[model samples]
Each structure stands twice: as structure tokens, then as C-alpha cells.
Target: MKNAISIAMMALFSLCCAAQNISVQSINYPTRYLRHSDSKGYLGEMLSDLDRQDASFKLVNAGIPDCPNCIRFESVNYPGQYLRHSNYLIWLSALSSDLDYKDASFRLVQGLAGTDRVQRTTHADVFR
Candidate 1:
């Protein structure tokens, strides 16, 4: 009975952890979600299973060791790849250098419009 209870608890914990996966949606276009295609990030409507998978991401700790408060968005389908911006455009890329880590890390703040929405703001200090 104790072993069964332990197993059930472990299963519940796994489900709770899996629930951390999130889909980033556009504020203006609620029907559209952030997705990567051809390594580029764009907003698209989730019409198929592939679309949904592309839209899904896991919020992980920042890849940079110095940025403890920052978070990085890791692609659900592409485990090692993370959401990053380069040349003022978002892309799904693998971390290779400090610049890549900095580009991927973002601080989550309350949206300017309201608290109901969350905004991912780049770490200005690192960028500048």
C-alpha cells in the first residue's frame, strides 16, 4: 500500500511539472501564438498538431550563469534550441556563446496594459 501511494504521488508530480509548458500568444491577435518556422519566430494560428507543438515552450532558468533572475524560453519540440533575438528579429537557435545566452534571457514583467498580461523584457544591462 505504501509503495502504491508513492508511485501515485510520483505520477501526480510529473503531471504538475509537465503543466509548466506554456504557449505565448499575441496580445492583439489572441488567436495567434508564437511559433518557429525555418528557425525564425513568428505569430501564427494553431490549426494543427504541429502548429501547437511549435507554439509550446518551456520556461527554463537563464542559460547565463550571472543572470539568476532572468528566464529563457526553450522550444518544446527542439529541446536544445531556445528563443533568442538577433539583428532585431527573434529566432530559435542553440546556445553557442555568451551572446546567445544573453539574447535568450529575458525578465518577465507585468504588461504595460495590465497585470493580466505578462511581458518578456530583455535584460537592458546585458544588451547595452
Candidate 2:
């Protein structure tokens, strides 16, 4: 009985951890979600809103030694590239060596609405 309880507890813990994956949703457009709508996953891809599945993303730790608050948005479907912003638009791109695209890094904070949360860009310091 004790062994069974331990196994059940461990399984519960793993499920709780996996449930923590975060997503970036539009505050202005509540029905729309941030995602890639382009055929080619290249730079300057169509960063638009969608009503369905591809919109969800995982908020990953940027892994920067100095920046603890910084985070990278990794797609639930495409794990390699991260959600990047350029020209006031958001798209996915791979983590390059120089890391010049730190604009992609954002801090999740209390949004305009009291209970809601927002992904504020670290570079421009604007809510998305």
C-alpha cells in the first residue's frame, strides 16, 4: 500500500510539472492567439492571430546567466525556434549564436487587467 501511494504521488507531481507550460495570448484581441501563419519558417514570417491549435506556445527560460526574468516563447509544435519580434510583429526564429535577437526575450507580468498576465518585451519594454 505504501509503495502504491509513493508511485501515485510521483505520477501526480510529473503531471503537475507538465501542466505548467505557458502560452502567449493577445490581451487586445482575446479570441486571437500569437502564432506563425507562414509556409516557410524563416525570418519575417507572418506573425498573426489564429483561433485554433497552433497559437499555443511554451514560455521557456531564456537560459541567460544574467537575466532571470527573461523568457523565450517556444512553439508547442516547433520546439527549435523561438517567438521573436521585429518591426512591431512577432514570429519564430532559432536561437542564434550571437543572440542578437534578444528582442524575443520578454518578462511575464501582470497585464492591464488585474487578474490577466502579459508578456512584456525586455528590449522595448512593451506589452504584447
Candidate 3:
């Protein structure tokens, strides 16, 4: 009887500990990790997994990027000497130019496929 009582108390202690989840986050930013694909061949292949059973379907939301801010690329007066293309990262802080194009293409092709996965957007829908 004592052994069974001890086991039950141990199980109860574990359950209480599990209930107290430790959240070690200071801040949360709205960010997404879209698959980046440079090849046209991969575009068609990305859609094959978006069946009805899959809950994590493709999605696209058009808004200002979280990084590289709202500054237009052409407007920036980039000094090509000390801050050469190699040293650009240290100068302007964060530059996500490659991610802007590469990830977008993957997300777009996902939209084009019109699966049970993608939330469809038409030209009309974009205007509103």
C-alpha cells in the first residue's frame, strides 16, 4: 500500500511540474520562414505536399518586410569603397535583399497552384 501511495504522489508531482511551463522569451516579432528556391524546377515540386491532410499549408501576406525596413534600394547612396558589397552588412545593419526575392518566388508559386492549402488572392482582392 505504501509503494502505491508513493507512486501516485510522484505522478501528481510530475503533473504539477508539467503544468508550470517556463516561457523564456523577452519579445516576439511577426516573422515567417518561407522556403527559398532559386530554381524554376523546385517551384512545381513545392506544391506536391499540400494535400488536404496537411495542416501547415502555404500562405502569403503582403506588407512591409520585418527587416531592411521600408527604404527603397535605389535611393540609398551606398559608398562602394570602405562599405563595399562585402562590407555592406556592417554599414547598414541588416540587409535581407536575397531573402526578399528568393522566398517571395516560392510563396508566389505556392499561391499560383490553387490548392486546398493556399489562401487565394486575385487582383481585385489586392486592391482592397
Local accuracy of candidate 2 as per-residue lDDT tens digits, 35-90: 56562222222244342335656666665655555666666676777777666666
Error of 1 at 109 (Å): 1.0
- State every prediction's TM-score relative to the real structure: 0.79, 0.61, 0.15
User: Which residue pairs come into collision in candidate 1?
Assistant: none
Greater-lDDT candidate between 1 and 2: 1
> Quick one: RMSD of model 2?
9.7
Collision count for each candidate, in order: 0, 0, 0
Collision pairs in model 2: none
Model 2 collision count: 0
Off by over 4 Å in 2: 1-20, 39-51, 124-128
| Number of the predicted model whose TM-score against the real structure is largest | 1
Candidate 1: tens digits of C-alpha lDDT, residues 1-128? 34443453344334334647878889989999999999999999999999999998987766455555467888999999999989888999999998888889887655665645567778858556
- Residue 65 lDDT, candidate 1, scale 0-100: 54
Give per-residue CA lDDT, model 3, range 44-117, as digits (tens). 22233331112121222224344211111110122111110221121111235644332232111122223312
lDDT of each: 0.78, 0.54, 0.23
Ordering by lDDT:
1, 2, 3
Q: Is candidate 1 or candidate 2 better by TM-score?
A: 1
Best by lDDT: 1
